[model samples]
Structure formats: C-alpha cells, structure tokens
Target chain A: MSGSIAVAGLGPGDAALMTPEVATALADATDVIGYIPYVARVAPRPGLTLHASDNRVELDRARHALQLAMAGRHVVVVSSGDPGVFAMAAAVFEAVEHGPPAWRDLDIRVLPGITAMLAAAARAGAPLGHDFCAINLSDNLKPQAVIDRRVRLAAEADFAIAFYNPRSRSRPDGFGRALEILRDVCADERPVLFARAVSTPEETLHVVRLPDARPEMADMRTMVIVGSSATRTIARSGAPFLYTPRSAA
Target chain B: MSGSIAVAGLGPGDAALMTPEVATALADATDVIGYIPYVARVAPRPGLTLHASDNRVELDRARHALQLAMAGRHVVVVSSGDPGVFAMAAAVFEAVEHGPPAWRDLDIRVLPGITAMLAAAARAGAPLGHDFCAINLSDNLKPQAVIDRRVRLAAEADFAIAFYNPRSRSRPDGFGRALEILRDVCADERPVLFARAVSTPEETLHVVRLPDARPEMADMRTMVIVGSSATRTIARSGAPFLYTPRSAA
Candidate 1:
C-alpha cells in the first residue's frame, strides 16, 4: 500500500491509552518498525510486517524503515511514549531530511502520544508543576562536557529535572555524574524523585535527598525527577509526590 | 451516577488527538463544567449539561461540578490541556482532600491530559528534547521571591524553561522580572520561544533571544519556552523551532 508515513505515539505502554487514530494507522500500515520493546507492545495483527531492532541501532533501523516507505510500503515508526519526546519522530525526520534521495517525498505526520514525563508526572502527583527540565543521562552520542554544562545550567535555574536513560550497564556512572552536578549547583537537601518503570507494573516512586540517591537504585529504564528547592514532598496516605508550586507560599 | 469522577486528558487541543476513553467519558457525562474557553471546544451532544465559568472561578466551578456528581449526576470536569498539569484536576483533588466534609467519599480519578508544555514543545519542534522546567510566572498565589529562586535555579541548570501564566495586564512586569532573573543565570543568547494560543487556529510561535524578547509579546494566555544553551534555532525555509537534543553532539 502506498500512503503517507505516520509516526504514532503508543501512550505510556498501555494499549488502552493509544489514540483511536493511531490504532487505526497501525492496523492500516503495511509495516511496523520500532525499538524491540516498543514494537512488542502491539498485539499481533494480520498482514503486518514487524521490523524490530536492538536499541543501539536506531539510525540504521530508521533508515531501513524510511527506505521501506520509499519502496511504497505504508510504514508506521513506533515509539513507546510520544514519538516527538525523545522518540522516533525526530529520528525519522532527520533521516528523511538528511538521508538518501529516494526517501525525501514521503508524507510524514507525527501523531501525539503520552510522553513519559507527563505520565510520570501524573504518577508522581505533579513534580512538573513548576518549571522543570528533563535530561537523558545516556552519554552514548553526547559528550560528558555538554551533559555537565546542561545539568549545571538546569540546577542553577532551579528547574526540576527528569533524567531519562539515567544508568545502563555500559555507562553505569552517568546518573551519578548528573546527581553530582545538580547537587553542586543546587542544594544537597533538594528533593530528588526516582520513578522506576513509571506507569508499568514495576512502577516505583520514592522521594529522597539528592545525596541519598545512589547508582544502584537506577538503571537505563528509570526516569528520575530532581525537584527545585521550592519542591516539597507532601505525604498523602503515606505516599509522597514531589510538588513545585507556582509559588512556595 | 455517583460512582466516581475521572478527569482524563484530552490530548493537546485537537479532537483527533483525544484518547477514545476520554472522549467516551465526556460523551457519557451528564454534566460537563470548565472555563468558558475550554467548554466552548466540546461539540454539542444530547443530555450534556454544560457549565461554563470565568477563568478566575475555576476552583469554585470544579467544586460545584464535583458536588453535582456527588449528588448522582454524571459529571466531567474539563481543562484545556492535561487536567493535572496546572489545570482543574489538582483543584478537584484539593477540593476533595481539603474542602468541606461532604467531599470525602466521592471516588476521584485524575485521568491524565495532554499538558500545554508537551503540546507547545511539539509545536516548537522538540524544545524539550533535554532537561527543561516549566514555571508559571503568575504571582497570584505564589510570591515573587519563590518565582525568582526557581527561575534562577532553572536557568543555572540550563533547562528549557516553559513559562505558564506568563503575564496579565495587572502583572505586566512578571515576565520582565523572570527574563531578568533568567538572563542572569542563563546565557543572554539563549532562545526564548513564545507559543501563543497553542493547538488553536490563532496559534502563533515566536522564537527570539532572551535579551531580545519584549514583555508585550507575552500575556496570560501565552506559554513561554526558553531553550537551554544547547537549544538552537535552525533557520530552515524561513521557519525556526527550538530544539534540545538528547545529546549535545
């Protein structure tokens, strides 16, 4: 089938939250391509070609998917959360914008999906209420110097920070480095919220001081939110959600 | 009708983006209440009692609606973006949590909605690619000192800052004060993105340097996104969107 390509957001790992349009698009697509885990979430449908790849081969996989689209296959490039929020939307656009000549004319629409930040924020009861920032501690493509600079700036601004790709087996100390930068710039007593597997069955959220969050508590899949000084942990029924209001008063 | 109230997120501002479940819930509600502007967006349907209120009376309106629900009316409390992200969801919970004695037993479901931050970020082509923070510049309930401290911290952390409730006629100098504080902490050359009326026809996005942005450009309806030092303006085909990459390669 020949049609415009759509980058759909499968909101927050739950199939129920997927937009009807996205669901239809996925069903209609001749091929579905994404990171293995994200692609695995969709139930099997008849006549759909699933192209899954390892996490590290994103660019290559994206290029291959675009080429499939160029070859007259309606392809849906999937991402776990909203495709644009650090997902496959940008990668697809970058491929089309800078890739092979045959893939330039394909129609691409980015469908909104639930981002982890929004889902996690909701799960954590509004840590993002005030100004907040998200940083991916994965230094695979980015240099440590740049990450440090951004982290330092975010801490100085007192923006609550959500750290994605915080720690992985290969890069174990990334989250630690980020915490160090934030602690140095902000206060050590600042509230840091660690939300592991947010929205999933293994979801765990805890409020800890910046100094108390250790590397062992986080992994690549964990999304950590470090709040500004104004952020406080309020306990409701013995559960704490970090909240930063428009004003502390 | 007095089962439970779910405040689900209608993604961004488009009906197409709204989740099916949320749309279904809205359709099934006997009473729907919200700020007038948001209330106007819902397509007419039979048996839906629409309660539209002024912006200032959101909390009161929410309480009134919840009371209606508690009185066995199927009620739906609507907000423009995600209800939880600085919207009516929190007010609903707050009312239930701290309001009069009658609200204790009402089943409260704070369904996630697509927040303006995510919508604005999408419109601006991923200004929230990395760590960023959102702060409401309105000092109605918050003190200026608190706002200043948070802005300073976010700037220092180098977050892409999204400013909600940026300005109003009475608080004309709010944005100016924020800009000044942000300038002191962040680089003067950092890009500031003003998304006025996002997800609506009159939507206009302006990208300017922090030092160059004027106070008159923003008002209460505007959501300002200030990019990190890593954020860059790609002058592609005379249109620019603020982008912060997962990595600063």
Candidate 2:
C-alpha cells in the first residue's frame, strides 16, 4: 500500500476548534507522531500506533514520521496549533529536502487549524482587527538579535504584535526584553493582552498597559498580544472588550 | 427571550473548515447578518432570519445586528474568515462602543476560524512558517500612504507578508504599487503566491517570482502572500512546496 503523511493542527487546546478535515485525517492515519502533550491529545485506537517524543526534537521526529510513511504506513504528525505556524510542517519539509529525492514526491499535506494567536484574539475582543505581526519570541532556534530586530520594526510599523512562546523556563527574560523595546518606541498606553492556555480550563486573560506589563505574566502556554496604537478598551461588567479599528491613518 | 451577538467566521467557503463553536452559534442564532455572499452561505432554517447586506456598509450592518441583539434577538454576524482579522468582530465592537452604554452588557463574542492566509499557506507549503505580518491592501478605510509604509516596513523586517483584499476593480493599482515597493526594497526573487478562492471550487494557486508577478493576477477573492527572505521552494512532480524555515540567524 502506498503511504502519505499529513501534518495536522489540533488547535488551541479545544476539540471544538479542530477542523473536521483534521478529525478525518486522524481517523484514517495508521500512526500518530508528535510531542508528548500533542500526541496525548489523539485518542488511542487498536490499529493506530502513537510515538510521542519529548520537546526540541522536531527534526528527528519529522524524519521518523517520514520514514514510517515511506515504509507504507499512513502517518499523521500533530502539532498543538497550526502545523505551518512554528510547528512540524516546516520541519517535515526540511526533512524531505535532506532525504532521498524521491521522498520529496511523498504525499505531504499541511492542514491548517485555528492558530493560538487567532484563538487568543477571539478570547480577547479582536485585538488583531487591524494590521498585525506574529513573532515567535523564544530565541532558542532563532537569534535574540533577530527577535529584537523584528520586535523593533514591528513596533515601528505600529502593527499589533502577537508573541508566541513568550516566556519559557530557560528564556524567562526574552519577553521582558521585548517589553523594554516596545516601551522605548511606544509611549502610548495601548493595552496588552496576556492570554494563557486559551480555550482551556486554565485560560486566563490579562489586559495591562505597556507600563504595567510584566514578563512574569507569560509562561510557555501564554500568547501575548500587544495592540497597535489605535487599540482601545471598552469597560463592561465582566471582562473589558479590546479591539483595533480596521482603518489606519 | 435573552439576546447576544456572535461574530463568526465561515472559513473560506469550506464547510469542513468551519469550527463547531461557530456552528453552535449559528444553530442558536435567531438572526444572521453579514455581506450578501457570506449570509447566503448559511442555510435557510425555520426559526432563523437572514439579514444579508451589501459590501461597504460594515458599520451599518454592525449597528443593525447590535440593534437586533439589543431587542432580545440572538444574532450571528458572519465573515468569510476569522472575524477578528480585517472582518466583522471589530465592526461589531465598534458599534457597541458607539451605541448606548447598556449595549456593553450584551453578550458579544468573536469565534475564530481558519483565516484565509492560513488556509492559503497550508495549500501552498508553510511559507508562513516563520514570523509574518498580515496587511489589508484595500485603501477604503485607510490611506494609501499607510499601506505603502506597512509594505516597506514589513519587507524591511523580512516578514512573510500576507495581503488581504489585494486587488479590487476599483483599486486595481494598490496591489501593483505594493509589489513595486516590495521590489524596491527586496531585490531577491522571493516567491509570491496568489491563492484565489482558496478551499472553494474556483480555487487556483499561482506561484511566481516577484519580478514576473502582475497586478491582474489577483482580485477581491484572492489572498496574496510574498515570501520572506528565508522562504524556499522544493521542486516536486505535481506542484512545488514553498516554506519559510522556523529558524533565522
């Protein structure tokens, strides 16, 4: 039997956020591969084998999934959010590029899902309504200088910025440094959203001004959204609604 | 006899991509309000009233929906993609902000979906795998200079740029001018993806070098993605895979 690999997104910790296409792909796959948490999300079936790996072994995991597919096993590589956005899809292609030329022709498809930023945006009140930039703030794979430069330029462009992997145990200060850079360029009290574990039971949203935003507010599960200059807050009985207007002068 | 408003996304013309959360909102809604085509996407039901409006009347439509909700009607405002991204969520919030103070207490939520750029990115490879910025190219609400500045800054920052509403008949030259500006800053022949009517029966994807790209390649139905400097293409028998790696030096 010929085999294929589908890199699917299991959207922001919510089953309802998952696309039906992804659900169908998971049902058809013979093997599932991903980080432990993501792999745990897929229900175990009699015929399906689950290979859950630890964090930071993306390339190795990608290669393994490809190897299995080449061995005529339909494999599904799952990521917490959209695989294309800082997830397994790129790594899968990177493996395909380094592997046999024939491997490039394998049936590899990236199924998009509701990414964390968009999920966080929905939980908050459309903070990404206007022009926005998404920057992965974990300086592990990329250089800190590159992260800083992107943050500065994004601030200069006045785009609302969504930061993924803001503060991890190892890189606790990266998000703090990013906040300092924002403060230097932007003095306005534009609201910043700290959306943690969105769509989950532990989901907590904090809206603070640039002056009051602390790096401690973010963890590995948090998605930080800094609004554009035009972002505003409308206070209500419950959580305040935040949004950036579509028009930009 | 209670009321609320749900600004939902009808994921790029695909029933499979529509989230179950949005589906639940539609099922619970008493009135559905949106652009003509988007409202038409919802099926006729016994209890549901469809209020389809023309384009360019977003705020008016928003106000009407808000009024319906205020009058104790469960309303669902629909957009083609995630309502938070250049769509109806902001407009609904805007209406609430400008309307009576009591409107703030009304139940308003933004349900996320598979946005156009993400859908297009998945069909193509992970061209948006790295840091990227989303910019709306229509100058109806914003100034031409604003779009120019954003395109230039985004190019300078080396962020994969996603252009929504890239070209309409009335503003044919906006996308062309944006391309010219990208060419001025970026001499490299980065891959430009024109994904038109993605996830629909009329779906067509064109990958071209920046120099060869033309204005007529896009329309209101198209989403244009210009790859970052890190973007690369892998040749295959069927269609080439385009992706931007997750890491940068």
Candidate 3:
C-alpha cells in the first residue's frame, strides 16, 4: 500500500460538527496519531491503531507519524479543531520541512474542520461578524511581548479578537495581563465572550462587559472572544444576542 | 411545530466539507434562504422551499427568514462559509435587534462550518498556523479607511492576514491599494496565496512573493492570504508547501 499522511480536524468537541472528509480520512487510516485527548476521540477498530502522545511533544509525534507513513502505513493526525490552526498540521509540516527530503514527496493533505473560535462565535451569536483577529495566548512558542504588542494593535484596529490557550495550569497570568491591556486600550463597555468547551456537553458561554471580565473565567479548554467597539448586545429573555454589525462607526 | 431560525454554514464548496450538523439542519428545515449562488447549492426537495435572492439584499433576506420563522417555519439562512464570519448571522441579529420584540423569543442557532480562509489555508499547507487576522476588504459596509487602517495595523503586528472580498466588480481599486500598503509595510518576499473557488471543481490556488503579487489576481470569489515574516515554503517536484512556523522570530 502507498504511504500517506492526512492531518484531519475533528471540530471543537462535537462529532456532528466534524466534516465528512475528515470522517472518511479517519476511517481509511491504518494509524491515528495526536495528543491523548484528541486521539481518544477516534474510535478504535480491528485494523486501526491509535497513537496518543503527550501535549508538548508535537514534533516528536509528527516525526513518528511521518516515519510510520514512510514505512507504508496510512497515518491520520487528529486535531480537536482545524488542524491548520494551532494544531498538528503545522507541526507535521515543520517536521517535513527540516526532515529527510524524501518526506516532502509523501502524500500529505490537511483536512479542515470547524475551529474553536468559529464554533465559539457561532454559539454566542456573531461576535466575529466583522473583521477579526485570532491570537494564541500561550507564550510557549512566542514571547509575551509579542502577545502584548499584537493585542494592543488588534484593539487599536478595533477588530474582534479570539484568544486560544488563554489560561493553562502553567500560564495563569498571561490572560490576566491580556485583559488588563484590553481594558486599558479599549476602555469601553464592549461585550466579552468566555466560551468554554463549546459544542460539548460542558459548553457554557458567558457574556460580560470589558470592565467586569476576569481572567479566571477562561481555562485551557476555553475560547475567549473580546468584542470590538461596534460589537453590541440585544437584550433578550435568555442570554443576550452578541453580534458585531456589518457596518462600522 | 415551533418556529426556529438556524443560521448555518455550507462550508467552502465541496459537499464533503459541509458538517453533518449543518446537513441535519438543512434536512429538517422547511425553508432555506441565502444569496442566489449559495441557495442554488441546495438540492430542491418536495417540501423544502429555497429562497434564492439577489446580491446586496442580505437585510431583506434576513428579515424574510425572521418573518417565516415567526410564522412557525423552520428557516435555514445559509452562507458559503461560516455564517458568523461576515455572513448571514450578523444580518439576522441586526434584524432582530431592530425588529419586533417578539422576534427575540424565536429559537435561533448558528451552525459553524469550514470557513474559506481555513479551507484555503489547509489546501496550501498551514499558512495560518500561527497568529492570524481575517479582514473583509469589502467597503460596502465599512469605510475604506477602516480597511486600510486594519490592514496596516495587522501588518505591523506581523499577523498572517486573510482578505475576503478582496476585489469585486463594484470595488476594483480597493484591493490594489491594500496590496500597495502591504508592500510598503511588509517589504519582504513573504508568500501570498490567492485561493479561488476552493474545494470546488473550478478551484485554483496561486502562490507568489509579495512584490510579484498583483491586485487583479483576485476577485470576489477569491480568498487571499498574505503570509507573515515567519512563513516559509518547502519546494518539491509539484507545488511547494506553504506554512508559517509556530515559533516567532
């Protein structure tokens, strides 16, 4: 059999949100490789093997997947959200770029899925209806200065911002500093959406004003969306509808 | 039957790219409303009514969907990409905010899908693997100044930028000006991807350096992605792989 690697996204947390393309890729794969939680989402079958690894060892996981594929195994790397967005696709590509030249010739395809930010935006109404920026809050790969500068510039641009990896056990203070910067720069009553584990059984969406938002509201599983100046709320009986209008002020 | 409005994304173009959640919503919907082309994507059935309206009639279409739902019809407002991203969700919310108070009581849900930028990014490798911003280059709702400022600020922040509606028949010169600003600000050989009709039979992807990219290379159907400084390419026999490294330089 010809060896291939398919990096597929499983969507946020819902099986229904996953694309048929990704589902087909998973079905055809001989080996599924990803972080523990993501790989666990895939059902094990008689012919399929699941290789779940630790979180921070993305490069090692990528190398392993590549090695398996090079040895005539069909490998699928599963990611919770779209693989291209802070997921396994880039790690696999990073490995391929620096690895043996023969790895570049392998059939590698990235199957897109419903990303967390978009799923979160959908759950909370259309807070990202206008121009928006998605920033990864974890400073493991980038510097805090880079995050601060990007947040400041995004606020200045008045773009709705979606934050991923906002708070983790190790990086608890980064989101707090981000909130402080937003409060300082935006200084308005724009809505902030704290969407945790969206599209899952534990999905809980909280909409608060900028002044009232706390950093502790978000965790590693949470997706945070800060509204632009134009983002407004429509008062309803239940949770208010939060959406950024197509028109700008 | 209770009245409901489900704002659903149909994914980029391929039927496989559409989520099962969206497919289920469409199957259960009594009426489907969207732009002419998008609505035409839906297969006609015995009971389902597809309202395919002309372009620039988003507000009217939204109001019509609301009216139908209020009359106890299950209406699905469809968009090519995720409904929450510069699509029908915001338009529906805009109508609800200004329309009758009873409209707020209706059951409304936004179903996320594979957005054009992400799909495009996946096809060309992971160019949006790092911090990125999505900007709508259409000046129909916002001013040209707002787009220019956001583009400038996004470039300054070194965020991989995705441009939607880069050029239209009515707005021909805007993308050119935006390109000039990018060239002036970036001033590097960073890759720019023009992904048109992604996932469809007519799909075409072109990659070029910043200086070599031209405005006419894009149209309303194209999703243009400008890579950040850290974005790189791996050359093989076929088309090169484009990806942005996870690490910041």
Candidate 4:
C-alpha cells in the first residue's frame, strides 16, 4: 500500500458546495484527520479510520496525518473552507518544510473549495465584485502590527476586504482593533457585512455602516466584509443587495 | 409563470468542481444565457433554451437575461468562474441600478463557485496562504491608470496578488505593462505562477522568478499569481511546492 495524503476543503458548512473531487477523495480514503468539527463532517466507513483532534494544534495534526500517510494509509486531511486559505494547506506544507525529506514526495495535493468569503459575497450581493483583498484577522500566527498595517493598506488601495477568523474566544479584542483601523482609514458610510455561520442552518447576515459596525457582531463562525467606497446598496421589499460596480467612475 | 434570474458560475473548467446549488439552478433553468464558450458547456434539452452571445457584450447579455426572466422564464446567466467576482452578477446589478424601477424587485441571486485563483492556488500549494488581493488586469472596464495604481499599492501591502483576465487578444500589451510595474515595485526574485486553463485537461502551470516571467506565458485563459515577500518554495525530489508561511518569521 503506497502512502499518500490529500488536504481537502469541505466548504462553509454546506455539503452541497462540496466538490465531486473532494467527495471522491473522502470515499477513497483509508483514514481522515482534521479539527474535531471538520472530522465530524465525515462519515464512518468499514475500512476507514478517523483521527479527530482539537483546534489550535494544526502543526501536530498535520504531522500526524503525514505519519499516517507514510505508514501506507491513504490519509485525507479536511478543513471547513478551502484548505489553501488560512487553513490546513499551509500548515501541511509548513510541516513538510521541516519534516523528513521523504515526506516531500508523497502524493500531497491541495483541493480547492468554495471558501467562506465567496459564499458570504454571493449571499450579500457581490460586495467583492470589484478589486478585493482577504485578510485573516486572527493574530495567532502573526503579529498585531502586521494585521493593522495590512488593514490600512487595503483600505488605501480601495479594495473590498474579507476577513477570516474575525473574532474567536481566545481573541475578543482583535476585531475591535480592526474596526478602529478601518474607521480611521475608510469612509464613514461604507457598508460592512457580518456574515455568521454562513451557508448553514444558523446562517445570519447583518449589514451596517462603518461607524455603526461593532466588534461583538462577529463570532468565531463569522466572516466580515468591509466594502470599498464604490460599494452600494439597493433597498427593496426584502434584504437589500450590495455590489461594487464593474467600472470605476 | 413567475419569473426569476440566477447568475451562476460553472467553476473553472471541471464539472466536478461545480456546486450542487449551481447544478440545481441549471437543471431548473428554462433558459441559459452566456458567452459562446460558457453557453456551449450546457447540454441541449427540449425545454431549456440556450442563448450564446459574442464577447465584450456583458451589458447586452445581462439585459437579454433580465428580459427573458421578465417574460416568465427561469433564466440562468452563466460565467466561467464565480459570477459575483468580476463576472455577470455585477453587470446584472448595474443594469438594475440604471434600468426600470420594477427591475429592483426581480428575484436575482448570485450563486458561488470555485473561482480560478483559489483553484490555481490549490494546485500550486497555497501561494495565497496569507493576506492576498485579486485584481482584474483587463483595461476595458477601468482605465490603465487605476490598474497600475492598484498593482503598485498591492505590492506595497506585500500581498500575494491574483490577476484575472491577465491577457486577451486585443489587449496583449496590458499584461506586459503589469509585469513592468510589478518588477519595479516587488522583489526581483519573487515567485510568479502562471496557471493556464486550470482544472481542465488543457491546464498548464509554470512558476518562475519575477524577472523571468513574461507576458507571452499568459493568455486569456491564464490566472497569474505573484507571491508576497514571505512566499517560499519547498524543493523536493519532484516538483517544488510554493507557499507563503502562516506566520511571519
């Protein structure tokens, strides 16, 4: 049994968004490894083993998956959104960078998914229709100064911003600091969207102005989008549609 | 006889990457409208009408789709990637903004898909693992000045930048100009990935340093990614895996 590993994205809480490629990988896997909730998304099979670990131990989990692959198991590591975007793909590669040289040549692949930002953008009427940047708001991996600088520069570039890991239990004040920076650099009336538990049964989307945007609106499951100056809203009988025009005026 | 319009993405080129939501929209569509190549992707059926148009007619195509929906057809407007990102969703909203007031009440929705940048990033080992921006390099809708400025600012932000519509027939010189700006602003040895026709049988991926990257390497089908300063490549016995580490070292 030749060993190999695949890092797959399940998308943001929607099985309907899972690709056939990802589905095929899961069906063919001899073992699955991931954070607890993501591992729970997979089903039990006769020949497959599940390795579910707690959060914030990404490096350890990645090394374990690699070890399983080396032991002749077809291991599949799963993440909620696209594995490449602030997710497992980087951590897996980080492990490979420092791990044994033989692990480098394993059948390691990164399968893409419909990330949470795209799902939230679709639901909110394409605030990312124009130029945009995605920033991971959590400072667990990087410094706060880097986050603050990126936010200011993204605003100055007039790019719509999508923020991942906006607010988690361990870091409650990060989103508040992000909001303060955006307020200082961006227009006061710019529309900000807080998309919580998107594409799930608990999905809720709230759109507010820059000044009125509060930190507490977002939780661990929330994806925040701060629109560019050109982003606009169309009020109607239902929730309004927000989009940035294709052409710059 | 109620009318509605759903703007959908077919993903890059692979049917497996298409979401069930998008598939559902296509199955229920009474009429499908898009550019020639995109519309050709839809299978022929007795009841579903296919309307394929020429290039550079986004506004016209959007109007036609809206008209069909107004005439009690369940119309699906298709784009190559996610419709909300640099595609049909923004155009449809633009029409509604300037067209009849009743158009505001139309049931228009944006269906997400696996976008080209994400697909390319996954195939290349997550070059966009950290903060990144997506910029459309086409100068048709916006002036060259805007694109130039955005490229410069994105480099200053040290973001892994994804360039969509990087090269086209009439605008062959546009990508060359972009390369010049990037070379001037970014590190000389920064990695650049030119992913052509990703997720398709004809797909080809090429990675080179910034100075070694040429405009001729890309076509209309290519998605160009320029790595940030922190982007690194892990060389193996096989092909190298490119990625920007999750943490700032």
Model 4: per-residue lDDT, tens digit, A1-249?
779898999999889888888999999999999999999999898999999999889899999999999899999999998999989999999999999998898999998988999999999887988999999877475777878888888888889999998886666788899899989987559899999988899999999989999988988999999999999888778788899987742
Instruction: Label model 4 with its docking quality class.
Output: medium
Candidate order (lDDT): 3, 2, 4, 1
Steric clash pairs (candidate 4): none
Query: In order, what is each prediction's RMSD in angstroms?
Result: 3.9, 1.0, 0.9, 1.4
Cα TM-score per model: 0.82, 0.98, 0.99, 0.97
**Candidate 2: clashing pairs of residues:** none
Which of the predicted structures, 2 or 4, would earn the higher DockQ when compared with the native?
2
Please give the distance, in angstroms, between residue A27's alpha carbon in candidate 3 and its true position after superposition: 0.8
TM-score of chain A for the candidates in order shown: 0.93, 0.98, 0.98, 0.97
lDDT of 3: 0.92
Q: For candidate 2, give the DockQ.
A: 0.84
Give the runs in model 4 whose Cα sits over 4 Å from its true position: none
DockQ of each: 0.40, 0.84, 0.86, 0.76
- Model 3: per-residue lDDT, tens digit, B212-240? 99998998889999999999999998888
- When sorted by TM-score, best at the front, the candidate numbers are 3, 2, 4, 1
Candidates sorted by DockQ, best first = 3, 2, 4, 1
What interface RMSD does every candidate have? 3.3, 1.0, 1.0, 1.4
Over B1-249, each residue of candidate 4 has an lDDT whose tens digit, in order, gives: 669999999999999899888999999999999999999999989899999999888888988888888889999999998998888888888888778888888889888989999999999898988889999877475777877888888888889999998886656687898889889987569899999999899999989999999998998899999999999888887668999887742
